[model samples]
Target chain A: MATGSFATSGADLELVGIQKRFPGFTAIEHLDLVIPAGSFFALLGPSGCGKTTTLRLVAGLEDPTRGSILIGGEDVTHRKPFQRPVNTVFQSYALFPHMTVLENVAFGLRRRKMAKPLELAQEALELVELEHLASRKPTQLSGGQQQRVALARAVVNRPALLLLDEPLGALDLKLRRQMQLELKSIQEEVGLTFLHVTHDQEEAMTMADTVAVMNKGRIEQLGAPEDLYELPHTAFVANFLGQSNLFTGPVLEATSHAIAVEVAGTRVLVPKARARKHSGEVTVGIRPEKLRLLTEAPPTTAGVNTLGPGTVTDVSFSGVSTQYQVDVPGADSVTVFAQNLDFGPVVTPGTEVWVSWKVDHGFGLEDSASEEAKFAPELDTATIAVQAKRDLAAELEVS
Target chain B: MAFAAFATGTAKEQAPRRKSRIALLLLLPGILYMMLFFLVPLVSLVMTSLQAPVEFGDIGEYETAFRWENYVVAISTYGEHILRSFGYALMATIFALLFSYPLAYFIGVKARPWPLLQKLMLVMVIAPFFISFLLRTLAWKSLLSDEGFLVSSLKALSLMAPDAHFTGTGAAVVFGLTYNFIPFMTLPLYANLERLDTRLVEAGGDLYARPATTFFKVTVPLSMPGIVSGVLLTFIPAAGDYINASPQFLGGPSTAMIGNVIESNFLVTNNYPAAASLSIILMAVILVMVVVYIKRSGTEDLL
Candidate 1:
């Protein structure tokens, strides 16, 4: 709904027609974003996807080759970094190595001419719960401690906006998860617009209100984390945000409410709203967790569920969930994640099963063949087998 | 499994032994070099420094004896020169650091984007090293001569006292030392500043630090290791330099340094004991100064 109206008046950060080009590569191009006041926003993308570049443009560390950066409705494109009412938590934490923790936090406040800089710095450290280590230098602190200091350093300034450039990337997984919650609580308490840049989809989904998935110098999709996870517009977003099983083929039928896409021998019914383009030769997608596995074939009832017979190629029990790889002959291998309710027959490799999911759960996708090519190779061998199976199934089903 | 564990244990034990063997192999040439050039000469110098002149013998004649008075005599006779040499060296170190820091900063940090300019500036810093240090000091002598173009022009512009000369002055000697050791100061500084994490500076700016504040608080403090090393590199050599302060170069008899005094005792006067004692004193003094400087450099805990 934030995209519904062009409300520039209260937008904490606005980047219009932002483009950054280095000597040989365009880091960002035609990027336009408006982050509303007090909203937590994240730019989620892989490396070289211009998410970091956009963050830098907003941070005033880089000049946009072609556009205006307006912060709090003020045109700050020509302003220096220090002149802007914004700050950043760098990926490396970039704490002043020479200064003590208290001194580091006090740095920005002192520059801003606070009346009681040390008192305010102590308050900031207490916010991150690191007041006890105030006298220690940055190198003396642990990775997690340094991260808290970095967060304290930026949040202490109380800028109109704060940019976190993968601030938790240096921590271990457990510490990262803990910091994620801590950062969210801090962001909520401060009520400042947080512009976080991260490649972690889970982190973005867990903390950010809005996530803009970037790829190859462009915003592929931008929406609420739930909306993006549920209704991804591009193949890149669907695959990058989480695991996705894509079925690209000709459209068999199209209606206002729904589009039936024929993939291999099975026809997938996706709501028209989910489809980026409801036309001929489109790609249909579904999430791994959305797919259901059944030992017996369900009734071939229309609108009930779409079904495909396949052999269980892999079964992994991950305590809470059991992930299955089902290979349909002449079709791609499909991934199905089922909760471990401990209520069904144990599915193992080489077992016969039917892959089924409701029609409404399937989503539509646009041209993702290129995006698929770039990130698809990083998928494990089972996923590749699924793709290979799809190719064979396409030829077999059509004939 | 038990046998494999035993093999792993033996492999672990052998690994350090192999490493030590390689270390010994690597250290053999260095040990040999130090023994032949440094340790042997050091022992001979100690013997010579302790030797006394033969009673009622010729001025140059001396014999090995426990005459610790050679050190006392050396200190009393050349104490002024010793202090003057260190003072001039300290001045040159400070001047070289001031000159090289900005040059290194501009080239290594600012001109990094322009590859051609970086190469050109680096070449300019190192080009002097390709020429002999003595020849360069001699060139400076000619340049600062009373009738030379630089001095004559300065005289015409009234920048210098009309009758004041630079060729034999202490200022000229210190200036010569600074110029000769500038690359020593610049290269180490450039090496450290070049790898500077620019993000810290940007972080400072993002934290609302003004440009000047960022430079002093973040950039300069982070470059301290470079400054300390550069000062050490320049000071150590400048203190021991002889030719730059010799009368044939830029110095006068009144402006003689410890190096010039030691050179005269060894080659001109054949006073071996005096030369040896003065050399040892200069080494001891420079070592103390270097250690004290390092302690106060604020980079003690850092690598």
Candidate 2:
């Protein structure tokens, strides 16, 4: 693992039954996750979903109320943040404003009494393509430059697990996309475990090998990004990952290969492997892009699930694709994303349309009603959001 | 039509000029106040410093003559007291900083969550200001006197010699100065520390710095502006303070500072020129010292 001069592989990070509780609410509850050595892992969630708390717990910035954390099989649950072999690229970059870029990057190495701190810091800066800015103070740099400096600062330490708490959340859109790719390549080159926490789903999907979608202090689903997006286990994951056309209904028949679910008087078949619940009431869901908006009724194909006789309520043309919101009978709304192939007629609002998708594309959630109820009110209140982002108030409560 | 166009162009050009004139007019009160209270007194003091004693006149009489030798005489005659004032002020500034940094840090950073406690602490620091400055110095004088409980306790504890007393010592005066001007030291430090970003300290700990290293490397460097301003606020006023260094207060004849010397010259001996010369010397020395200190501290942007 340590063959080259600056090459040090990561250690396995294990969180065993971790739980974090604030004064009035639980931030994380019963989280047991393991990222294999040298893998890029991401904890994906909305605000206040305990992703940041999980990162802090692993970084030793916050202690779990009822669990242990182990890195490479050694317990670090009670260790100070500095004692453990972990570093964080904080959300705000938190670069020492008084220090030059070189000094800030060299801080950890110097503190650890490491050899050739300046040279190593320069190397890290070069990795981020910021060697020319080594002498500038953090405040002097642009947001993108400061972000790279923060990355260099954390990566230079070569810690066992580098925790990134929304490290690129402050960047503009173009810079954010560029940093995402650069962060992925750097993680691969360093071969260290990068535990990234972010609320941006696209960022998480693009940068991580395994993404865990968290909701209300629990992992809603954990899998490869494609798997999580394709077959979500919970309604929260299905909605959060991307727009979903969901239909809540009771299972009409449970067969070996698939389950027939009745949604608004129409039957839809979800693959048995994709159905989180097979014999009871379930919520069937499909990605917006997976459904097709048909001007006429779809053919009575053997393997297609269709919901029709709806009016197109809204149509949005987004350069590469066209999104249609269809108000179907007995169904609130069904969204469909059609590629701008330019071969079909332009469908305007108030046009009759049918939303259809292949049966195998449907995924079913077991606990549909309660999860949907919890997701709706989260967006309306301001207090809930403030409470969610107040995870850094540990010291205030502890004292 | 051409004449009308020319008149409009001139009016347009005069608009900004008239606005600037209004700006100057708005500044008239402040400028007049400075001239009346500051510039006039400064000019009068300079004139008095150069005045020579009138021949065969009263003790307070002097005639206008450029006696530059007054400065030379002030320095040569009262050099010890001048040095003693600065020395005591320097010690008091250091003591105030040492005492207030922790208190300010605790109030600004540690007690941040309990806002009520922070406010209470600030109130306690400024509580001395409610009473008159002279009263506070007089109170300290009595507290440190030979028969006072504090001196008696120290004597009984063997921390002080049995024959020793505190009423007239240099330490007593410095203590009085530090105690009196502590709020000056604390308020600026607290203001700066209050605006400090605590995430930087957390970053220090995340980067392998222990608590003490984090404090020295991060917190202290970040609080330099506060420290510099606090030092200035305490040192400048404390250097010229007389009540704490007077025989009527905490100090005695041997512990006389430049302020006590100036007081005696002005009121007792009626030496107006000498007192004015000494005041000018004190101001010049403080200005030079402050400039050098600010330059060395590298917080010139604060000014």
Candidate 3:
């Protein structure tokens, strides 16, 4: 694991210690975020994880119970939504049913007391490629077209920050993809900071320059999409962002450069930064794509510290990749995803194989004292029992 | 083979036979009722309005010669009453709308606990219905009388003298009409305004529109269907209502509406032809007003 120094910079809008509490629940808790200007930022999380609440706080639709929201280094926490230089494209699009498309886009300009509202509205409609449908009502347009109308309505105001709350949630899958690219390009062309809230991980990873993964009313991690994917700081991020095969172990030795640990009765070495000091136990994390399977045991390569003999328990072909679940010694199953690049012949189920990966591929975590921690003592026992049962059943079937 | 073919053909034609019988059965009772009640009565009313009087209390009076002059006399005699009825109806509609709009908007849009407010409003609307129409009108009369509680309150406030009178005047009649019909106006407006998509309002506010601008641009225009219905309900009933403007109530000859004239001509004066003619003309005027209103408001679908 390669570690980088923590530094906050290039943020135009900063949310400092933001907190919001509803009657019986705290929707957000001490949320600190810095959104860089001219960046497409996404607040990605599960449902009811305060993603929408954060967006609403920034939009001034809801006030924070204890925090300040600063836009471009000026405090805007007390300002009304209309008073702030920000606009929102609501999830439902919320186009006025009583007005034509042109009028809907022109509404903000008219309210701002602009001299040439019609001309501005026409230009906006043209930008969204909705000029021909200007005379039609919102109900007359398709879902995608209505989404464009909403985008046009928000962009016409020329605000410094544009907020979008699941604007493409109503579209079909193909249309959603198209609109995602369009939204990204539009944000680039306008050179405005966009704060988008969505629960779709792929949507966030595809469009946003930076993704903030939130869980349980807190930001779990915030970084570039690729960095977050390659290096997740927690087990939650590892599982949430993509798939990971985790291993439990106890650290035997530690240094500034590397740490040695025993995982599933086998000695393994991992980077020092990945090892957190704890009483006895730690968790080892490895991406499935990094593991390799070989039919015969090979000599250990430099920096490759862990190898184990296992039987292929399950083999599933997923088009571009093939996933293998290997049942290793001490009753642990590790998954490995191998690219299907005509790699000789595929391994069959119940085949004996050796799985190995580099030391840097595995990151260690401190054994958590919390009850709700993912790697509990009972989970290890359960895995051992299930693996023993499966091995016995397979032996009997083979006999 | 020929007999089997004929049997198949007959089975295919059996569905139409059952359908034809059902269609005839459905039409039979309605046709009989229309002929016996509606068509016969309409033809007799037209014929009776045309007949001249032969002898008083004679059954054959309607068989006399057709007298077209009766319509002319009816109009010349009761024209003022017809005009007063229309004027009162219009005034009542305007007043009801003025009072009900804000109340409906507030209750429908601004009220947080909407179910409770809706139940309360429903109770208020049906409260008058629980009392007899005449009893409600009489109650209004008592409230507007010279020595009524309202007049006394005004006198106590030094806004009026102790002897301020409201009975037997056009204002009292209009007030009675408005009070009776206000709920009719409110319910539809509340229904429509409550069903209004609040997102549209929020969208307007997000676009930097003030509350007032949103009300006019989105709220009012979307609620036109309700407004038109309320106007129709209040205006039509208030115009045709003689009970509220009768002499037994807070009304006089100056406050007598077209319904009063129709009632007196038919019951008191025993002038059936003139009464029928006046009724026809009043119906025509109301029909024309409804047509004009529907076309102007572009809410003909609501009708």
Q: Which number leads on lDDT? A: 2
Deviation from native of the Cα of residue B251 in model 2, angstroms: 1.1
Residue-wise C-alpha lDDT for candidate 1, range A1-399, written one tens digit per residue? 121111222238988988899999899879888899889999998777888888888888999899999987889999999888788999889999989999999998888777788988899899788999999999999888999999989887777788999888778888788778877886777677899998878888999999998888999899999899898888778888887888877889998898887776777788887788788788878888988888888878766455567899988888888889988764588888898787533788988888777788888887754457875345433454477789999999999
Best by TM-score: 2
Better of 1 and 2 by TM-score: 2
lDDT of 3 by residue, A1-399 (tens): 001111122227899999999889999988999998889999887667798999888878889999999987889999876666677999889999878999999888888877688788899888778899999999999988999899989988777788999888777888787778877777787678889898777788999999998877899889999988877776666666776777666678776788777776777887876655533676667888998889888687878855577899999998889999999887378888999998633899999988888888777654322322543223232344477789999999999
Q: How many steric clashes between backbone atoms does each model show?
A: 6, 0, 0
Error of 1 at B135 (Å): 2.0
| Ten contiguous residues with the weakest lDDT in model 2 chain B | B1-10
Indicate the worst ten consecutive residues by lDDT in candidate 3 chain A.
A1-10
What lDDT score goes with residue A128 in model 1?
A: 80
Q: Which regions in candidate 3 have their CA more than 4 angstroms from the true location? A: A1-11, A274-280, A305-307, A329-333, A343-345, A365-399, B1-51, B55-76, B112-114
DockQ of each: 0.48, 0.42, 0.36
lDDT, model 3, position A166: 84
Report the error of model 2 at residue A267, Å: 1.9
Candidate 1's C-alpha runs over 4 A off are A1-11, A113-119, A129-132, A265-267, A300-302, A328-331, A344-353, A368-371, A374-399, B1-57, B61-79, B111-120, B155-162, B265-280, B300-303
| Cα shift from native, residue A321, model 3 (Å) | 1.7
Query: For candidate 2 chain A, which ten residues in a row score worst on lDDT?
Result: A376-385
- Measured with C-alpha atoms, the lDDT of residue A133 in candidate 1 is 99
**Order of candidates by TM-score, top first?**
2, 3, 1
Give candidate 1's error at residue B194 in angstroms.
Answer: 3.5
Model 1: which docking level applies?
acceptable
